[model samples]
Target: MYSKVAITGMGIISSIGKTVEENFTSLTEGKKGISTIENLETIHKDVIKVGEIKLTNTELAQLLGLSSDNNYSRTALLGAYAAKQAVQSAGINAINEYRTGLISSTSVGGMDMTERYFYDYFKNEAVQKYITAHDAGDSSHKIAEYLGLEGFVSTVSTACSSAANAIMMGARMIQAGKLDRVVVGGTDALAKFTINGFKTLMILSDTYNTPFDNHRKGLNLGEAAAFLVLESDAVVKEQNKKVLAYVSGFGNANDAYHQTASSENGDGAFLAMEKALQLAKLDISDIDYINAHGTATPNNDLSEGRALIRIFGEKVPEFSSTKAFTGHTLAAAAAIEAVYSVLALQNNVVFPNLNFQTPMEEFDLMPQTTLKHKEIRHVLSNSFGFGGNCSTVIFSKN
Candidate 1:
């Protein structure tokens, strides 16, 4: 009943890899990028492990060819790099050739600099230029300008689910015939503010994260940027583009239960998945694999596990959370997982949920612990954020 939106290009720069090919190789090799923090200066660096990308801010700026005096924050630098990859991967020589837009998401836009120079801004003039890049929309604008896109650029900041909502919005805009092609995803650089904020909640894991395990501690914060180029059928047909996957279903719902935790029953998550299925016109059985938003936090896994049982009853399909491999990327979690879902559909394999040793006693749910080969048709990806914001996106092989 709805027009299918095709995903033609994807680009990602995470702790595991700098490009799509490199990320795929890391996933296939069962490599985990979680480690001690190397970039951000934080007091908890000794105890907290994170999925920090190895590139420094200067190196990232160099990669984007920005001058030393450029006001681009670390967020903008990483976003521009990944977005440029997405545009290039999509094979769009002229960005404005067709009606194209960019929808990016970020939680801590430029806080890395803001927190660093909070007091020094009064005296230091050289670093004061970064003050303008502190807003959430500035990173999106920087990414758009770098990609040569001048149309319909916006940003979403629903915390962790921001990128998933961005992808959903891009798909809807395409379905509504508002744009021929659009780039949608999220970016966030590790910042002291976020690390300290999460620490205040007592969810920062000192060791490796173990999703769905009884002894699971918590999440390791990470920083990365990922983007997917979604185009309509007309654009794909006209250009004969290579369709990587189809954005068949997407939904968003808010539980409104708590500011940071999901409802005890995962009501918002269930509604989000139900809406996605309805849009896809597919049943629960059609989902071959699920890239869960298993942040490895006690509340998220328990709530999301309950939602799984509620949705599939006794026949839940194979599901795993790739968070352990890339740590919890906050806003970019869903975007990178969406890339992993497309990869699963293309390769017919499910990535193993690393660091799982014990199953939760609350349910019989067991994550995929090994890379298993199978014929995957539809892959479901869930992303639940703070303030009970829950989102689901389904990718189907074309």
Candidate 2:
């Protein structure tokens, strides 16, 4: 039998909340955060809604107490804030005291700032500092430096599933005895780059996104970050850590079906889920809840729903998509949902998928639309990204 990776603590900043407890409260209270865009400068402001965080860049920097000259991007600021919370929650006085590492993911990277200074790069020396921050790994380095971490630090950019892949790697590393503990998650900020990109694809919804609904339009782009501390069994024993949950199983697969759309059959999603269940030594009936990758985009919801019915046949578990509460957060979607999954397990409550109305005509499946209270032991979460990257991780009550 394989050893289980313990999740000691978690942190998050989203349209829903800025901390784990706050996010939990919002989830249980059925509070929705998707609304009009406020922080971004885009022509779609009047056309689309997003789960944008209310804090400004300067405000976030102030929260982290960064110097005015610091080149911390919005992604880095959000990451450091959430990572600090995770480390503090884990009670790690000395970060390098243990064999620790940080694995962060971000598709937005510094694009938020890059887009703002795109035309002023040569004309303005003031914004040149942000030019170097315009990649996927820069924020990881900044977050590491901010946290005083000097060990293995890396960033994963698997599109929307980036954070879930980061968590999967952290768990595999702990199980392989490569490290004693690790902080893993992702961060992102909304920008015209992604806004225009998805807009060109014509998937931006005009109002609230409704996952699995028959008349679903598309997804609303959002921004946020989240991180979780995963410790090995030996470290958990040594530190007497109070585990919030266990990382029992994870699986990732690529369907290579489309550049930006999931296959009609959800081939990658199916293999990912199947492999996760097998790794967890779990059967179809064992999963108590499913945090689906239901982006509400017509292609995604239909593809994911088909995958669910294919996997469990007629017995798909209580499933819901929290994206309605926090618009599709690109790279950070899985990380925040991971926090949501843990919250569901901790409180024994399944969050309602807001905005869902009529059941889809493609299948007979329906998501849990009301707050459901049940004995949730194992929660399976799925995150699929562009380029057919699909991932799933199963979290169990400790």
TM-score of each: 0.99, 0.99
Give the poorly placed runs of model 1, Cα more than 4 Å off. none
- The predictions' CA RMSDs to the true structure, in order, are 0.8, 0.9
Q: What would the per-residue lDDT of candidate 2 be over residues 229-265, giving only the tens digit for each residue?
A: 9999888898888999999988999999999999999
Q: lDDT per model, in order?
A: 0.93, 0.93
lDDT digits (tens) for residues 81-188 of candidate 1: 988998899998999999999999999898887887778888988778788789989999999988989899999999999999999999999988899899999999
Stretches of model 2 off by over 4 angstroms after superposition = none
Q: What is the lDDT of candidate 1?
A: 0.93
Q: Let me know the TM-score candidate 1 reaches against the reference structure.
A: 0.99
